[model samples]
Target chain A: EDKVVQSPLSLVVHEGDTVTLNCSYEVTNFRSLLWYKQEKKAPTFLFMLTSSGIEKKSGRLSSILDKKELFSILNITATQTGDSAVYLCAVNLSSNTGKLIFGQGTTLQVKP
Target chain B: SAVISQKPSRDICQRGTSLTIQCQVDSQVTMMFWYRQQPGQSLTLIATANQGSEATYESGFVIDKFPISRPNLTFSTLTVSNMSPEDSSIYLCSVGQGTYEQYFGPGTRLTVT
Candidate 1:
């Protein structure tokens, strides 16, 4: 079965602190890894990483994928209360069907 | 990126009742999918709504329980039949814009009493 696992199921941190969320996957015909942030409703797209060593960044958030290691990491710097949300990791297989295997997600709480 | 929206953002219903959720996309998409997210659980693909054809359901999901209709490339609907307390979940509609990146709608929150 295709599985995506995330570490630190839940985390609490103070504002201004940096946090790192981890995602590891085991699937066949790997294609790309994506990160999303869910506040109270829909999940907003964050990053899509397909290459190793290279990092994709957006403002204070960044992510990287290590295909060989079958893992990825998302980093948030100088976090604020608004950054509190459930971070989801999903792996897209090469199956032309465009199916996504998602992780259980990491719930992050940034307190002021 | 495509903008997606869903109707009946949240609904509270009694057991044995049914609900139909609608999904609309700003742009025509080739692929539309329905997913279910149980409380505190990850999202699971329910089926692939194929335009002009019967939907392809995922394992553990049946058409009789969750019938889907894709009338066009930009619109789709999922009907949950004979609902039960265990059927309470958040149903999300996502569209694939010719890539692996799928954009999701706000989702329909269902609560069965």
Candidate 2:
């Protein structure tokens, strides 16, 4: 079975601090790793990483994948109170099945 | 990008009752997926609803318990039958264009008592 593990299940940081969330996976036929931000309801797409050493970024958030190590990291710099939410990491297997195996999300709280 | 809408934002049901959640996408998508998120947990895929085909369920999920119907490319429904307290969860629907990522709908929060 494909499995994903995320570290530091919960974190609290002051405003403007930087935080890093980690995700490691053991998936057969790996394809891509994805990051999402969930506030209350729906989760919004943040980044998708396909190759090693390649970084994908949007605003204050950036992510990178290490295919050789089967791991990924999401970094949030200059965090604001609005950045408080659960950050989810998921992996898509290469089977074209449209299935995603997700890790238990990291809950982040940014306090001003 | 597709905008998906789900009906009955939340409901509190008694045990043994059933709830049918509806999902509609603003734009046509080739694939729709259903997932469950228990409190303080990660999301688990329930099934993949394909247009004009039977929904493909994941391991530990059965079609009889969570019946799904996808008549076209933009719409689908998931019905949780014979609900128990364990069935209480947040159900979310998602749509994709066969790409690497998917857009999600506002989830339906169900609480079975």
Chain A vs. true chain A, TM-score per model, equals 0.98, 0.97
Residue-pair clashes per prediction, in order, are 0, 0
Classify candidate 2 by CAPRI docking class. medium
Q: Could you give candidate 1's per-residue lDDT for residues B1-113 as a string of tens digits?
A: 99899999999999999999999999999999999999999889999999999998989999999999999999999999999999999999999865568889999999999
Q: Give the residue spans of candidate 2 off by over 4 A.
A: none
| Complex DockQ per candidate | 0.73, 0.77
lDDT of 2 by residue, B1-113 (tens): 88889998999999999999999998888779999999888999999998898999999999989999999888999999999999999999988665668778999999999
What would the per-residue lDDT of candidate 2 be over residues A1-112, giving only the tens digit for each residue? 7899998899999999999999999989898888989999899989878889998888899999999889999999999999999999999886477688889999999999
**Reference contacts preserved by each model:** 0.59, 0.71
Q: Which candidate is the best by DockQ?
A: 2
Interface RMSD of each: 1.1, 1.1
